[model samples]
Target: MKPVITVREYARLTTDKITEPTLDLAQVSVSAFDWLCKLNATFSNAGAALVQLENRCLLKLDNYVGVLETPCGTRLEILPKHFEREDCIKQSRVLLRRMIQVSLDLPTREVGAADLQNFDAPLSEWVMGRFLLALDHLIKRGLRFDYQRVEEEQRFLRGQLDGVKQMRQPPGRQHHFQIRHDIYLPDRPENRLLKFALDEVCKATKDAGNWRLAHELRRVLLEVPRSRNVQQDFNQWSSERLMAHYVPVKPWCELIIKQKIPLAVAGEWHGMSLLFPMEKLFERYVAASLDKDLLQDARLKTQAHTEYLCQHKGKNFFQLRPDLMVLHQNKSWVLDTKWKRLNSSGEDKSYGLKQSDFYQLFAYGHKYLAGEGELVLVYPRRSAFDAPLQVFEFAPELKLWVLPFDMERGVLLGAPEGFPLHSQQLQSSEQSA
Candidate 1:
């Protein structure tokens, strides 16, 4: 027997990598908290909030970012002040690796800058995974959350998302799945009649082992049969000859028609799809939303102009890394994705301006020269600041953009405002960044 699979089961396992216990909201997912905390250390406020969300709450956000990228999808990167700090994992290198992979894999074949979408995956799962693994390399890394609390807490959040209760029955000896699907066929009146005629012709042809009969039957049903024999010119038919013609195959027509279908069938397969349309709508929404990130990801692989590299001379270092790198034609700029909060005003600012970020980008500008090229910093969208696209200058032409992201909405709208820069975009970028 096939093992039972439900949308609920898929969600639980994929979300938690576990089957039983489900998930709780109040206790917070330990894995989520740990991941967010570590993300905060490396990325920032975006990291901090991700953990808080894991605890359970009705949250909605929007964000966007613009960056100049390397061919391997490297965003222009700058190191934060607390580099290698105990709480932080060194993700800059791993992040750069993602940029590099995207740069090399681009369909355009450019060098210094490419979109992050290309590089974000392989690196996130592999390089980033290793980095996280190394972060846990310490003997002290222990559980920070309890599964029971999170499961119990999950109740409150269910009301906010659809299909949360499509839960599976407890696992048992009988493996099973809640099969769900839906189908839609053209609904036009003409289409319905055509479909009906086609079905009848096919049914008749099924008994005769002839496919040409089906084709001619289609024409005949539409009402145009010029002659009794297959050799007869269908062209000779008058206007009224077509519409409801259903000529069964003629013996002589078989001589002219050499091909036939061993089996004939008709009508849409509705059983599979009809079983579940609501579930399909939900599934479709998920797929559409997820794909938004893939298409809008601005991780671009762009190569510096020959002149830009030649100026660097000895350091023609075959490799360069930049996240959120922006480019127009051959001109380019760069930025990095940060998950941390941007605290402009506060007695104890959780995250303020990082001198190191300025210094790091300054070098990239000094070498890559953003004033000549350009550089920017991309961050997740948050409520801490309203209308959060702020610009800071390390150099005149080089700028930093604290873009917004809406993780739920995707880039289906022609040129959606954010550069993978919506709330959903913000979340996905920071997750990989």
Candidate 2:
């Protein structure tokens, strides 16, 4: 049986030959391992492995499960656990789907029962499955292939020959006349890249012993031309062209173009492992959720950039980009999401809230919220810090709220649970507005 180990970011694990042994990664997974190493993961000299998941990557691995396949056909499953098992997995799925939509710039779709059925499946399988479904849909609508002009020399005339060029080259001594003709072809860079990605996913599915998914991917790959030198040629296409022609596959294509995921190559194993910064994800989730649930007439802006923190020699520097800014009735509320776990025992010490964070929010409070409005620091609700602590007295006018954003509930708890100031101030601000 394959060994399953649970870990989190910066978690270290020593290989025990007796109980759990070190993995001899398969070529494909080795390539995936290389990708991880490029990120924050490290392998020790003592056959131990350490995965230091940064905010971005942890966000990317929504399910927080990584499957490493070995050359010996054995598998090592690494599940990063930070919260309760079920809650963590559920949260991961939600984040993963959101990340996919954001990366693709696609609209968020409701998660159906069918999608949740595969909640326990490997993340790669789900991603590839979604990709395949999209690809298949595009194929049904007729794969977008452009009529690219090709110019080549041939002994025999193929199309309308270039008389000027033919004259310059003259007739070959062995073959006779050489002709250059412009021929329209379907084998373009965009198509090739898509084909390459499909093939890569297919191989990964096969390696995972997921024949069902592999079969579907193979069927789709059959329709696309076997792309060669895709990595070298993929960058030539512009985003505009991709959106216009390859609308269905545009997101996946962008994933490859941006190197957010891995491109498959023949003779070498390659896979994609995505990571998301928890800070950004938390901020986005809060901003989006608040916009939908909390504010009615107010405008919500994320990473709202309005002013520079300071000016030097007539030069503006240090731009103030608040995570979430809510504007209502001529008043702005600046809220920043922090992914740190608050400790109740350290209440005297700001509940493990860094002094720098407080200073940062102070700047936001003064500059963006005009000192009188609510300046909030949001954190995930933990058992220790389930409720919002007392508001910080940054100044007489400015108030700093330490609130808990309930991950499981997907809402900002109020008062003793969260920050009471949030709802109260918003209501007061709205009544005045």
Candidate 3:
């Protein structure tokens, strides 16, 4: 197995092992490099958003963060941009797992950063371990048994005989009965799908613990055949009250079985890519945190589609969807989350804030808040950009608050007037400094 390479999103990749942040492509085997070249070629052809090949020997990762493996067992762990510092790689993984848990609403309990200090594995193996844990819990709780419909030709007639098949049988084969019967068994679609996930984990996991757990679970699920058609089995699955324990494990199954990621090059590369767009993940994590930590007696709406930019040909065009909208006491506040970092002391006084974002948020403010309410732009809290920037006032009644969402603490830090913020979440932005 090749040594696992860790890089933050947007890090440079070169052929020679030169420096700290830039991934030395030389560490990968020739086959793995060829596979990466093929992936880059495919992504270039399809206009994929995963990585960009700057030169023949260089690659630039886009705004995606996850674990991807090459066919030659070259594992690459792409972390969030906020984990730029060298000492924070483990911290990054922990927080990334937490973000995934919250955003995807995986039924796993809170896993603190300290809890995973010893388990230094990539996201893929960590996720596989979580799945195995859930599966083990489920097995201890007892697997669900259902009366599954089975069809077979047997010496003994059981349940209802297939009349057409029975008649179609040869005359000398009277002893064999073509029967369709309902048998109570644990080999149902859900279990079969889980078996399929277990097989995938066994094949793909690089961690020793995950591999061992996967093999153990595989033995337990030996009677349950692997899923032939995952989609078909999922279609057949039902969220009946009995399989509540399976809920936590189901997401892991889908994530592994489907290799849930936006990049399409995984199929051609014949490798595992469990990537998520940083912007989307950040947006969802912030929204979920707000809904959980605060927002009591209030409603938090995501992707609010209550307005459109303009009308053409008597039809609405460019529908405006703010990342989040908080409704409280018959009043509304609009908020948007940006995954980009900000700088306070730069040649540009805007603190790396994009003008286009302001324009977009300006439109959202006018449309969603009628140009009279507070708007917020949430960015991930980092070392350089720990404090919130001063508010931007578009008019006497309208203002914009650029706040830092502390990823480690899961708190939105800023003081925005008229915004419903709990004291615990309303720490002074400078305090983080």
Candidate 4:
């Protein structure tokens, strides 16, 4: 049976995340340690550090205070991945939610420089991460730069023709300069990888402190600029230009601030990272889909999420506005979005499930039951084509599938809850890596 874990417990375990990072200086059984590392378990990658003397180690595990260890004479550089650990993934999620909310609460007027710093930076980072993913997705699918404007430059080579009218160099205000390196998009992977690679390049670049990120990239190749984190600064610096090209994210913000629910804007509000790069389990993931549904039915797709409620509540009162609910062929089913984790064996995760979750679904089943009222818990997956999907039966003829949203790291894997794979599925790195 899959272990059931609670969201409350996950938060409790996450409080000490990033607080402890350790290095161990001790003599331990090398074979024992190696075995752990092989399981994607935490082990000292730098085991040789503690060969002779004790060293300082940062312990990041939950409720565990920092410790100094000298096992024997060898040193160990170990990191923990377990129930209690400071994970970057968790931190990113929390920051993203808060930043989105904060941005929504601000006045509709142009968010000022102060606003950009106080709120936009964090939100900008989240958007940037999403943008990075989108850019990655399109690039992998053979997308290129939108449009490039190039002009022919005929170089005036010296001595091309004997006695060609010689013109003396006149010193004047230099209005323009030409770039040397031919700027052309590389092949697919290279183009898709450029953003991520550029991020790394910007970090190491001596003039990174001088780099900026306005709507368009402008290079001051003539005189290199200083370096610092300037992506947001660039965006704001070129706000005038940006406004001319890109519409403000107002309607989207109003839904969250005024409505507390960020709705879709022209069906482009919610961008799917899906399995192409990550999971689309958040309520925001369906913003675009909801907008379309609402447009068609005029009243449908309006559901509960903090300040709102869906169709009806059951006797047990487990409230849930499913990711999607539609009446089809005189019947309706509730589709719920779920993010999943795995164990070393690549099987369904029982670790993160909470008992309350089952009850909530039970309520949905009771209230939304039609025929064998269907309820699907959707998850992001690699290649569903490689493995057989495991299903659980809630009742006789009543099925609930913990299905996969088949999206590759960059390509569209499949669809929501639609496992587009055969029974012979291959295990993923979620277990072995």
Give the number of the best model, judged by lDDT. 3
lDDT of 1: 0.32
Better of 2 and 4 by lDDT: 2
Candidate 4, TM-score vs. the true structure?
A: 0.33
Q: Which ten residues in a row have the lowest lDDT in candidate 1?
A: 269-278
lDDT by residue for model 4 (323-357), tens: 55644445555656554443323453563445665
- What would the per-residue lDDT of candidate 1 be over residues 29-143, giving only the tens digit for each residue? 3443343244324333323221223233221111211111122222211111112232222332333333223322212222223443343322212222222222222112321
What's the TM-score of each model vs. the native?
0.27, 0.68, 0.89, 0.33
TM-score winner among the candidates? Answer: 3
The lDDT for every candidate, in the order shown, is: 0.32, 0.56, 0.80, 0.32
Candidates 1 and 3: which is better by lDDT?
3
lDDT of 4 at 251: 28
> Going through the candidates in order, what is the number of backbone clashes in each?
92, 12, 0, 44
Across 1-433, the per-residue lDDT of candidate 3 in tens digits comes to 5667888888766665554444313244556556767776766677655667787667678888888788777888888878665677878888888898888887655345465676677898888888888888889898998888999999998999999999999989988999999988888899999998888888887777888888998898888988898889988887988878778778888777764444424564445568788999999899888888654777899998979998999999999999999888978888999998787656568888999999999999899888898889999887778887888999989889999999977888764755666744445443575
Off by over 4 Å in 3: 17-30, 41-47, 110-113, 150-153, 157-180, 259-265, 424-433
TM-score of 1: 0.27
Error of 4 at 58 (Å): 8.5
Per-residue lDDT, model 3, residue 181, is 96
